[model samples]
Target: MRELACDVAIIGAGTAGIAAHGAATKAGARAVLIERGPGGTTCARVGCMPSKLLIEAARAAHDAREAQPFGVVAGEVRIDGRAVMQRVRALRDDFVASVFSGLDAIPEELRVTGTARFADPTTLIVDDHTRIAAGSVVVATGSSPSLPPPLRPVADRVLTTDTLFEIETLPESLAVLGAGAVGLEIAQAMTRLGVQVTLLDPAGSIGGIRDPKIAACAASLLGDEIDLKLGATVESAEAVGDGVRLTWRLESGGQETGTFSRVLAAAGRPPNLSGLDLAAAGIACDEDGLPDFNPRTLQCGTAPIFLAGDANHERPVLHEAQRQGWIAGGNAARFPQVEAPPPWPAYSLVFTDPQIAAIGQAFDAEEAHDWIIGETSFADQGRARAMDRAAGLIRVYAAPDGRLTGAAMIGPGVEHLSHMMVIAVQEGWHAATFLDRPFYHPTLEEGLQSAVKAVAERTGGTR
Candidate 1:
């Protein structure tokens, strides 16, 4: 067997692995990046890009459909699913090519590609043929979509986020198994594209991570276009002729049934730890096959193996994955003297009808505490009103002393809103000061000020 050596070996070339390679090399460590398949993130090829492409198509179609309402009567807005698929395919190809080209821009000495499995603590078998002896190893292997038991047998018609992207045509109707970020986004996007959609979740409301009021507002915006099966679980789902049948139990233990042309399983994701041979490296994985590592350092049980990204037992958001990757890469480069990376502040965005974004601890924490809470409806935002869309809300949560604990926004421009919150959370910005900071007039940013003022009022800031 051919053998090579490096200071660090990073497995999985998704967002985390890609970031780790650059960070490690910048830190002056020799690193090799190994990917089992074509290099690009789920966000690149499947999750974010293609999904958004589909959504944009739907949005255009929606606007055309509404043209008549504005006294500009037009003929039917028809969509050629094949053309949509073609555009998405071209975009996906370009995205993959761009990522690979960027990876190549790194010093040639810092990258390699192939499947890699642990041979031992500091050694790996690459592509089951070549061996790599490294000083330290970082596992950035990301997670895979979780498919529940009742739906697993229908893998042919039922799809995961990864599989749904490859489909050539849109389904006439889609049943989404989870109302979390993935399901909600696709459900609404597909609904806008003229597909009948149903979204089911075991949680009491959709976007379970967000505040209840925010989630409810989002659901309201979705309207009757998509049927919501909140607080429901599928008891069974099977192919019935050209469509599928689903029997579910509601939160109240009441039985319910439904049918659709396609089923999408977006329940969640489990870490990709199956073939790593963690046992050979003396690393410990939990019953779920995820490494038992320190959240701060990502150090697996022992002997220089570290976990990053979805492998570290956290929600698999891209930001968290990138943070873990950078931390693990830096730690691997520095070895024994490496100080652990700080605890990552959690953050994420759910891209449903009205996108839901949050930062810091999720809003459902059980701390009994004094808080300043404020909300601004999208109706109040000038930009949203101008866009003819005003069906969302923004909220800020602050401690009794006015420190920003968390912030969430469910509406248009959420991606931009999230960028500001990331800085606010990281800087520990005082709710009152940041909220009072000058905001561009008639913009969604006004929502930030409104939320801050609301929280301040709750904290008796007026006094």
Candidate 2:
């Protein structure tokens, strides 16, 4: 076996792994990056970029169809599924190419195109041939689409975020399992694109929004565009003809059945720790196969190993993954002398129409006594009315002392509005801080300002 040495070894050339590689090299450490598959980050390949492309196409088609309400009657709106998917793939390829170009800039010897398994606490074997003795290792292997056992038998008929974008033509109808971010986004997009879509979620809420009101608003809004089945449990899924037949039990103790041309399983993702042989490295993993690690430092226990990105299963969002990657890489490079930065406020967004956003501590009814609630309804907002998209709500939470603590919203432009709240919550800003900022008229952001002011006034601030 060929032997090599490096200061840091990074597995998986996805977003987190690439970020770790850059940080490790910048820290003056010799690092090697190993990737077993295509080297594009998930965002560029399947998760974010391509998904957004399809969503944009679906949005345009929906907009054209809805324009008749404004007296701007366009002829029958038609979507060529093949052409639409082709454009998504074409653009997706460009994005993936850009990522590859960046990877190509790194020295060839530093990049190994093979699977890596732990040989020891500080050693890795690549494809059982080349051996790497590293001072520290950063595992950013990311995650894989996880299908429930009931759906496994019909896997060939199921689509996931990882495989949905590869289809050349859209299915006539689809059954979307799970109403989290991926399921909601794709389900709505597919519905708008004229596909018969049924979205199922075992939870009472949708989009994983913690705030009950926001979750309700999301379900209501999305339900208008798709066949939403909340609080439904799938009993079984079987292959029937060329499609899938699914039987589910509703929360009301009733059974429902559906046969669809395809099934899109967005259930959840499992950490990609499967062939890593972590036991050889003495890394203890939890029942979920995730290594115990510090969220602040991204270090795995006290060992010279670190876990970052989706592999850690802490915060699987792209931004959080990149942030964790940097932390893990830096700590691995400067082992025994780690730097732990102050944690950033938590933030996440669901990209469905009337986007759902959660920032900082999500609102909980049981904890209502400790928080002051401020809210606004987009149904009456001037901007929402002008756009004919008036639906949903925004709720802001503050402590008795008037400091912005958290917020959840389901409304037009909440994606941008939530970022503003992220900054305020992270900076420890008071509700009055948002109220003091000027809000442009007939804008979605103005609705956020109104919500903040309402919260501030309720919390002893002068309006």
Candidate 3:
């Protein structure tokens, strides 16, 4: 077997792995990046970019169809399924091309092309050909679609975000399981594009939302567009003819059956840790196959190994993955002298119409009982009314000290509104702070401002 040595060895060349390599090198460590498959970040290939393309097309079709509210007369809108997929594929290729360029620029000698598994804690065997001994190793092997046990029989029929966008033409009908971000977004987009879509989730947790009000708001609004069957668990999934049939038991113990041309399992993506013989490396994984690691430093219990990205199984969002990757790689470079990265406040957005968003301390775990909640409705907001998109609510959660801790909303442009919310949470801005800021008239900011102002008034933040 070939022998090699490096300061840091990073498995997986996706977003997190790439960032990890950069940080490891920047920290003065000789780093090797390894990949087992075609090189490209998930965002560029399927997860984020291609999904957005499909959503944009759906938005255009939905807008034109719903334009009667704006008193605009329009002709019949026709969706060219072939053209839609073509554009998505073409643009997706452009994004992938850019990512590939970055991957290509990595020094050739440092790039290992094969699957890597732990021969020991600080040692890795790449496809049984090359043995690498490193000071530290980073497990950034990205996730793939984890099909539910019931769906395994009809695995080919049940698609996932990883395989969803690869369809050259839109299916006539699609049954999406798991009403979280991926399912909701895909189901809604497909529905708007003239496909028969039924969205179901056993947990009924829509958009990964923790705030009940916001979840209800999403359930109601999105329920109107698609056949949303929340709290339904699939008991039996079978391939029937050209479609798939699903028999699900509802939360109420009632059974319902549906058949569709495609079924997408968007419930979750477990980390890709199959071949990495972690046992040999003295790493212990929990019930979910995730190792104990410091979220801030990304170190695995002082074992000179780190977990980042979807592999960490914390937050699968691309930005968080990349953040964890960089930190993990840097720490791996300089083990024992590990330092946590500076903290940043939380922010996540779902690109559904009337975008859903949450910023910082969303569910309020141990401090739940202490949060002072303030809210405003978009039903009467001037800007939302003018735009004819007024149908949602915004809630801000503050500590007893009146500092803004988090905000949840399902409203027009919540994605844009999340930027300001993130800033407030990051800077530890109090309700009084927002009261001092300028909010223009006839704008979405005013609506958000009203919510913050309410929080300020509740906490005696009014000047």
- Candidate number with greatest lDDT: 2
Question: Per-residue lDDT for 403 in model 2?
Answer: 93
Question: Which 10 residues in a row give candidate 1 its minimum summed lDDT?
Answer: 364-373
Q: What digit string (tens of lDDT, one per residue) describes model 2 on residues 306-420? A: 9999998888999988988898888889997888898788888888888889999867778988898899999999999999989989999888889999999988888899999
Candidate 2 residue runs with Cα over 4 Å from true position: none
- Model 2's C-alpha root-mean-square deviation from the true structure amounts to 1.1
lDDT per residue for candidate 3 within 139-170, as digits (tens), equals 99998877888899999787888888788899
lDDT tens per residue, model 1, 1-463: 7788898899989888888877788889889888887668867877778888877887788788877645788897787888887888888878878888887776665556677788789999988667999999999888788779898667677889888878888889889998877788788888888788889888877765557777677777775568887889898988898888989999898998888899989888778888889889987766777667778877775568778887765767777788888888898888865667566566788766567888775676466245566778888677887777777888777777878778777888888887787778778877766765668878877777777777777766632
What does the lDDT come to for candidate 2? 0.90
Q: Rate the local accuracy (lDDT) of all candidates.
A: 0.79, 0.90, 0.89
TM-score of 1: 0.93
Error of 1 at 95 (Å): 0.6
What does the lDDT read for residue 129 in candidate 3? 87
Number of colliding residue pairs in model 3: 0
lDDT of 3: 0.89
Top of the candidates by TM-score: 2
Q: Give the range of the ten consecutive residues with the poorest summed lDDT in model 2.
A: 454-463
